[model samples]
Target: MCFRIVIFVLFSISASMAQEPQEYLDFILPLIKEAGKELLTADNYQVEHKKEVYDLVTIYDRRIEDILINKIKKKYPNHKFIGEEESEINGISNLTDTPTWIIDPIDGTSNFVRQIPFAAISVGLVINKEQTMGVVYNPFLNECFTAIKGEGAYLNGNKIKTNGQTDINKTCFTYELSLARNEKYGDMYMYRLKHLTRVIPGIRSYGSATISLCYVAAGRIDAYQCDGLYPWDAAAGVLIVREAGGYVCDSNGGEFNLMDPNYLATSTKKLSDEIMAIERIADEERIRDAKAKTEG
Candidate 1:
């Protein structure tokens, strides 16, 4: 009986210690720093159009991604990867229970190309299909935000927290509305933008979703709403916001998914609920507008 109890206890302890987010965070710090240094020194970076004329990828994107994936693979041969460039060719990797590393080498490729300092090399670690840790590094701006599942979020080695502003009338917000330039997504984003504009003082659009989320995590912004984001784009930033004591949820006020994280992240749940209400109103208005147009 004593032997059996001891064995069970050891097994439980091992299971609990199986996947450590801090361990993963430690491993990634040097890698992102290395990538950052290269980015800062890089000039004459080659660029190519992805899906749209404005959607661009630079040579640094691939090079930095390869470095992260290769280094991580060397350490954890069994780990999986879902990277921006790699997904463009092989498609997104399956999100299984196995440990996976999500990588976005240059989240703001356009910003990087345009010499904007908002670009970041973002990464997230998922264990058992749940985001357990994340890191977002903007080298040009010298900001690195990090977080683990239970541990608090941090920026530049200092602990961080959301501002926790609850008033709907006093919210500062950001989103990606450039997708509206494409006809297929225009109404979907424009309607929400119109409603949001009426309530908020002025809207800010950072071409980089990673930066937007990081800024929210650091309490630099009160709320951020984004849609049509890939896993890598939001995976790291979402975890950072959540760990910073912010609320991250689906745009429809549903449970947020790390795999498809088209989310509304806010400093507080009350703020999230308020923004969600505005979004609901925007949706209804959009439906009415579409119906009227068709009837006309």
Candidate 2:
């Protein structure tokens, strides 16, 4: 009787776990679409700077964040929320193991401010410290990227996958340097960019992390790398990439941590390794230079 009870309990737990991501995805999809509609129709937005001069925030960022947070909190009162705008307002810095919603209401605020039509709304759901679901919507382009853990990724209701390109020399890569918050890191980023540009055939920067990751998932780009990113910036996109059969990790080829400020993602593990090799060399040189300056 005890053994039978244990089997039933295990089955129940498995069933619940399997349904969690789907449930969250169902709830978030419509919300994301609605928010994207709001962004597409928005006008006369007031923009402001965050900690850095280049770090921008707009009124729509706050409005959309508030709308999402309020709706989510109403639905799941116990679930936690980590929003970019709210984090700045409330000083929330850490992510816990509880179910949490990590959101970047306007992922490409700079582009939005410039009317560049390249921005997106990024939403990531984490449960027990693992990314379970992600949704990214580009209203201007009419593209919606969605993923549920253990399931495949989708773009506008169609399955997506990485380009599966292995050759670094022939691949198109994106290196985003705008997210670097400090001057020292900016210099290091430029140094790495110079080396990568020499080896890789086509290099581009779209200035939007969310869209960059989606593009990688959709096989539009071979790889994307950047440092000094927040969890809200990567939480959604990383899951979508992983579900789309891509590889993601820290720049050092370590396991991906959403809280970490650095990220390297590629369509294939081979391509990731090749890019990391170059990044590793640049990182070593940067470390040596920093140590030399300190000792000098």
Candidate 3:
């Protein structure tokens, strides 16, 4: 009887440890901070050939990724990690169902290379392929945005929530113009921006996806939109935005998943819909433009 009771007690303790979000955050946050600090020391970054035109990977990016990956692997040897550099190095292209760490060592590589303050270290912990904990750190700004699945999001240890603002015309908009200006996607975004500027009081672009989402959580910005952002870029921020009483999804009004390459995160559902409507109009105009060019 005592043996059985001992086994039951051990199992209960193990389950509780496994289920805690704080436990995961305790393991992740410091590693991200350390990696971010080390990344700042990298001055000589070599950019090589890649599949995408503007996509770049620097030495600092790889070094930080290695640090994060090594730390996670050492602590949780069984857990899987899908890092941006590893994916590029190995040419691996799929996310798995195992407990995974989705990491963007430096989210805005272009900004990092240019010594811009908007780049960040984005780290997310996924359990059974679902994002559960995220830590986004910007060393240049000394800001940390963190979220644990149900425990709520935080900025520098203070509890953060989305400002529940409903006034669209009075709201501020943050845009990410990632796609090339001449591409069809770029044209669509341009038209949407023109419409948004006329409706909103102010528009801003910080060039960092993680920071933009963090800004939304902190109520610094009312809404943000972008096309072709990867899962690692927004995984942690998505949870932060949603937990702060904001809604985030793809442009089509569908549920946004980690795999989707587009995101429209806002303070309210109404704003999200309005933003999507503008996109639809821009898309229609792009189609019309293409047709006109062909006919001419």
Candidate 4:
């Protein structure tokens, strides 16, 4: 009977929170701040390697994720979660129609381990399979980027938007060069990097996908493209960028898919088109080169 009552109370709380979904920011922000405080002062990162050498994780990553998920599960017991650490341990969970939280306890563990300010704690809410709310907080830098579906995006409690740049060469481009280390995808990454460098002046890989996407939303960077990221990495930041009036699409010049998010985000549609055209040309060349090599 006690267990049944507890379950009923949790379900009720979740229903109430869902009704006034805007209250989500209120419930999550404080928890992020508290976790950030701990992150900022931790003397040792206790980092470890994942699948790749560049793929790093720290104690704070798991600890902060636990804190966020535990608090949220207790407060809204009926809700579901897809968190980075939990997913790592239990295998990635499938999204359902139920309201779900997608979380990356620390989005840039490499940066966090190095004391780089680009690291962030990312959380995004999905309802009926649509991304509805997002928060990416970089405790080391004290920047919090937030967005609710159709409500616009904000940074540090102030409204933010992209710069509306469209010229391909003129736009500031960002790419995650480190991911090119993947044995399977490295060749494609290399081709893109080579082709893009020849067209654009340079590129920036700031080591954090969440902050880089937030940067696009804030107009600090004009464009960002990355592939091979988990749902938690893109869920929050992608929504934030869209809310800030930026253009986002699957890296393949199609609609964005949160689950397989290889995306290109830009200040405007024109820029997205121009960049995608160039990428198509580069990929064509890559295919031709591979065919020639195979024939040889």
Worst 10 residues of 3 by lDDT: 178-187
Best by lDDT: 2
Query: Candidate 1 residues 1-296, lDDT tens each?
Result: 99999999999988767556677888999999999997899887679988777678888998999999999999999999999999999999889999899999999887888788889999999889988889999999899999888888999999999998898778889877775344556777888888888888757889899999988889888999877788998888999999999999998999998777778999999999988888889999999989999999
lDDT of 4 by residue, 37-147 (tens): 978897997778876676788888888999999999999999999998888778877889988999999888888777878888999999889999999999877899999
- lDDT score of residue 277 within candidate 1: 89
How far out, in Å, is residue 110 in model 4?
0.7
lDDT of 1 at 59: 82
The local distance difference test score of model 2 is 0.89
TM-score of each candidate structure, all chains considered together: 0.94, 0.92, 0.88, 0.91
**lDDT per residue (tens digit) for residues 10-30 in model 3:** 999988966776888988888
lDDT of 2 at 147: 94
Q: What is the lDDT of residue 272 in candidate 3?
A: 79
Q: Where is model 4 more than 4 Å wrong at Cα?
A: 1-19, 179-181
Clashing pairs in 2: none
Off by over 4 Å in 2: 1-13, 179-182, 285-296
Decoy 1 TM-score against native? 0.94
Per-prediction RMSD in angstroms? 2.0, 2.2, 3.1, 6.0
